[model samples]
Target: MIKLLTSADAMLYREIRLEALAAHPEAYSSTLAREQGKPLAWFEERLTTSDVFGAYCAQELVGVAGFRRVDGAKTEHKAVLWGIYVRPQARKSGTGRRLADAVAAHAATRVEQLQLAVVSENEAALRLYAAVGFVEYGREVKALKQDGRYYDEILMALHFGGQGS
Candidate 1:
């Protein structure tokens, strides 16, 4: 099942976030150690956001994605999509697609463009994002650094007028 999350869903959110960080340390720029110190209030606020969505399998949280409404006065119609991650065992099992679909469905209602960045090395994610109608807009060289190594990032966007399914 795919659904919007609430602050009350903190436990599930924390569990899934930890799993993602542990399983794909290279895929995400953030590390579990960094997030462990964050206050619960941070995640609580996220749970209450109008744009956060989650995907579950038999009631187990399997994936999560969120679209943050643009803050600039002139960019309200756009939203930056982020925090997209799926459990290792859940990859390619439709969990990622369902999570993305839920976000896209909500974006269709308010956003003109949905933008996100993916590490250049994550081919599976790139393919999945493309399958969902996101097209690469540009690439940033040495956009991310971790453990003394830098990684490129690909910026992608899905316009509301394009096919997304």
Candidate 2:
């Protein structure tokens, strides 16, 4: 099952978020050390600010995806799909695709485009985003650096083509 998350789900969200940042450090720009020090209230505020979706299995939150609209006037028509992750045990269960679709569908209601950046070497993530209609428009070479190494990122976006105002 999938549902929009709220401040009430802060604790669970924090746990999963920390897991994602730690286990897949290469996939995210944030460091586990940075978020680990944040208070629970921060997570609560995040839930209230960003549209976060959770996928559950028997009441356990196994996956999460976040959406945030751009703030500038020129960028107001765009929203970003961020912080997407599914637990290892939940892999191959269609949870990631479900979360992606949910985010895409929700974004379509409020923005003309939904954008995301994925590490270029992550084939699974590339395929997942492609399956959901996100087309790559560019690639930033060495976009991210960690521990003296760099990784490229693919810039992708799904355009709603006036379906969203």
Candidate 3:
């Protein structure tokens, strides 16, 4: 099941977020160390400010994804897909796709386009986004560096035609 997370889920959110940053350090822009040191209130504040969703299994939060609109008049029609992650046990269970779709569907209701960046070599994630109608429009060279190693990211977006086809 998938549902928008609330401030009450902050602890669960922090736990999973730290897991994401640690398991795949190159996949997210935020460092594990950075988030790990943050207080629960920070995560609670994030829930109040962002559109974050969580996937559950047997009432346990197994995955999470977020949608945040760019702050500016010119960028009001766009939102970014961020903090997409699923536990190892949750992999291959269609949890990621479900979470991504939930965020995109909810975002489409308000934005003209939903954008995301994924590390180029993450084939499963690439395929999952493509399946949801997000097409790559650009790629950044060595966009992210971790432990002195660089990783490229493919920039993708799904356009909502009624507003900006």
Candidate 4:
């Protein structure tokens, strides 16, 4: 089920986050071991955030996606999607789509646009974003640094002007 994540779900968040980091180091900025050192309070705070959303299956946390609400008095109408990850076994199912849909729906309530940065090399994620109506606006070179290497990212955005159906 897709629902807002609570502080009580911090352990599950940590578990799935580490799994994502370990399984796909090239997909994220933080390493598995690096995130493992984070204190429980960190996850607790994250789960309690107003912008965070998560998906659970059979009582097990399988996916998570969230964003920081845009700041500034005028820019509060936008949010950038981040920390999106789903278990390998859960891909290709409706979980990813559901999570994306939930995020978009949630964003629409507070923002006029939903934005996310996807690594150019992550074709699966690129396709998923496109399938959900996130058109590519442009590319940012060397958008992330990992292991002393640079990774380019595609900047995609989905405008909420009668797009959601």
User: Which prediction has the highest lDDT against the true structure?
Assistant: 2
Question: Across residues 1-165, which tens digit of lDDT does each residue of candidate 1 receive?
Answer: 888889988878877877777777766778989877778877787677746788888888888998888888887877887889987778779888888878887888887888888999989889989999999999999887877888899999888964342
Query: TM-score of model 2 relative to the true fold?
Result: 0.97
TM-score of each model, in listed order = 0.91, 0.97, 0.98, 0.90
Write the residue-wise lDDT of candidate 2 on 3-72 in tens digits: 9999999999999999999999988989899999999999999999999999999999999999999999
- The lDDT-based order of candidates, best leading, equals 2, 3, 4, 1
Runs in model 3 with CA error above 4 Å?
Answer: none
After superposition, the stretches of candidate 1 with alpha carbons farther than 4 Å from their true spots are 161-165
State how far residue 5 of model 4 sits from its true place (Å).
0.6
**Residue pairs in clash, model 3:** none
Q: How accurate locally, in lDDT, is each candidate?
A: 0.83, 0.96, 0.95, 0.84
Better of 3 and 4 by TM-score: 3
Clashes of each: 0, 0, 0, 0
> How well does model 2 score by local distance difference test?
0.96
lDDT tens readout by residue for model 4, 32-141 = 87789999988898777756677887887789888678888977766888889988777888888888899998887878888888899999899889988898989999
Give the clash total for candidate 2.
Answer: 0
Tell me which residue pairs clash in candidate 4: none
What is the TM-score ranking, best to worst? 3, 2, 1, 4
